[model samples]
Target: MHTIFEPMKPIPFSPPRIDEKTIEAVTEVLRSGWITTGPKTRELEKKIQQYIGGGPVLCLNAWTNAVELMLRWMEVGPGDEVIIPAYTYAATANIIIHIGAKPVMIDCEPNGFLMDLNKAEAAINENTKVIMPVDFSGLPVDYAAVMEMAKRHAGIYKPRGENQSKLNRIMVISDAAHSFGALYDNTPVGREVDVAAFSFHAVKNFTTAEGGALVFNLPAPFDNEAIWKDINRKALHGQTKDALSKTQAGQWQYDIVEAGYKCNMTDLQAALGWVEMDRYAQDHLPRRKSIVARYNQAFQSCSWAILPKMQDDIVESSYHLYALRIQGFNEDDRNALITHLAEMGISTNVHFQPLPRLSFYKNMGFQESDFPRAFEQFSNEISLPIYFDLTDEQVDCITSAIKDYMQSR
Candidate 1:
């Protein structure tokens, strides 16, 4: 008897959608010789602002840094508490800690990924300064409900800083890393909250190689444009003028206002984002939605499968991730299923492990058992590949692998 080896499928979990257009745009930026936070970056920011149709948009290096800047600007510090769901990625909670603020982790809604607004409301106190709700897997967390909750707690909100005083209420910053094109109440997500941060990381629906943006919709008298300018400075060592402006004749003189962090988006990175933005609404998003629809159809009849909510009357996801849940699956069962799928040459991932389960948050005295709903979600959740480049055949292969594994079990 002769032993033979089988070739594995070449399917990736999530890859950036790169094409000639992207290459050409990047090449153009490279040839321009003014790559760091120049015209290309500004162009991308303007394009994002126009597409969102919300407020001023400020594009920065990564989602984590961009949002951390916003938190710093809001003056959130040690004694302040920011409400967030424990079901999100570590970046969500890490940023809170980075800013010296306490992250008041709460449970997810009974059967959903979004944070429970009731739990969030109950967690509020005089120290509560912000409510950073994540749009997990691109599904919008009831923005209206979160906004109303913030408003209801206005009486107890303590404004420690000028920016916080301006709002006079707890700010609602949407961790919209996965929801660049999602809609809430038929409107784009950015406008729903006071500020929404979008990630253009390689794996996100919209990729910039590495980038993120903050769309400000702060209420009247706040001057979002002024805030955008201020954040631009804050993102660049608090410099009076960006490198692009400083390059001009007789514009060399500048001053630093605050000791800020360096996380400005480079022109080369923005070029990729600009090209993707061009085809996002027409090509990228539709294809992702189609893939999700196919997945939903493939698993809908299975008794063990629980399909993710992509769209409802109030919200529409960007179809960033197909977060499927296996009914009655425990942590061990889910891990085994993942291994089985891997053996079949299919790539799958858990959207998150829940912050409390991780070593850092756990040591912070955050227990997984305390947030039972979050733990329940994490134990059985599987994030399947859903990207613009993924073909229908690949989707079928993935679905077949999952069904085969579940049926065998």
Candidate 2:
């Protein structure tokens, strides 16, 4: 019974690849005695901005904060309606609820992870202030199409204040939690949209354990630096000075500009992020792509395989989540497949169950039946493991398992 596959070799869904360099970086931060938001945190922000090719980047505690902060900064409150896709995690719409704004959800495109832009256009009105599109499975949405849609509805845009007045259209803040290094037309994900918020959550391709950032790329008339300062201050209890500034002689006294929430990233987290960021495009991404290629090759001939798009000439993913779908399969079929995979020492996940289907949103009057496209995408979806450290053998085992189950039926 000789076999290449290790029967008991456990493969996690998305295990982080924190190497010696990352550990050393974090250890140095710990040894430096400046643990909380400090030099390392600021340095990571700058590095992210440079990598994004010109944007005022500000690090936050979570992607949720990045989304909420964008809404708060835009003064999108009561009576404002932010258009969103029904096919995303709750975090995307929860921010709108947090700000007392309405999240007008549009159904996803048929068999697609992204929102239906036509539905988005139809959803727009005088109350529409922003459009939050999720970068599902690390794939970039059509920013150009969304932007063009927003422009067409310019005449109906209602401005609440100076920030809203500057832009005579709906603001697009992409919830790019899964798309750190994804590309659209050779431009990075952050640059394509008005502003993009990326997550570095523990399971994400890029990890700081838990952190997020917003790329400030507001074109003309809008002071990008001022926007960064504003968001930075808001993320840190509205204090006039950050800890780095307070460390200076006679600068101990500071003013509270306004009541703000605390959502700043720590130096320890930033140290890990610095290491991950440096290796992302170079080492991590290439390996992840290879793993994906292995899965694609293995599943290429399967009749039921609806493989997740890796990339084409115009778009490339960060290879965050390998969300595979089983054609003509329902929720029961997908869950059974997950159970079968689990029995064989492989871990799998579902990309998302559309927000409308959740209990909370259901209680809030959202029905799963309303977003038919999203539900269709969800029912048969299963996210496979794809990380920098995932091996070709493991990919083969995982894909073989999937194909076996698929073909048996």
Model 2 has an lDDT value of: 0.88
Kindly provide the TM-score of model 2 when superposed on the true structure, using C-alpha atoms: 0.97
Candidate 1 segments exceeding 4 Å error:
1-8
lDDT of 1 at 51: 87
Steric clash count of candidate 1: 0
Q: Report the lDDT tens digits of candidate 2 across residue range 1-409.
A: 1133557688999988877898899999999999999999989998888888867888888999977988899999999999989888888888899999999998988778988888888888999999888888988888888888888888989898889999878898888999988888886678877898999889998999999999988878988999999999999889999998899999999999899999999999999999988888898988988888888887787778898887777888878888899999999999999999999999999978898878989999998888888898899999999888888878878887777777667
Give Cα-based local distance difference scores for all models: 0.90, 0.88
TM-score of each: 0.97, 0.97
Give the Å shift of residue 150 in candidate 1: 0.7
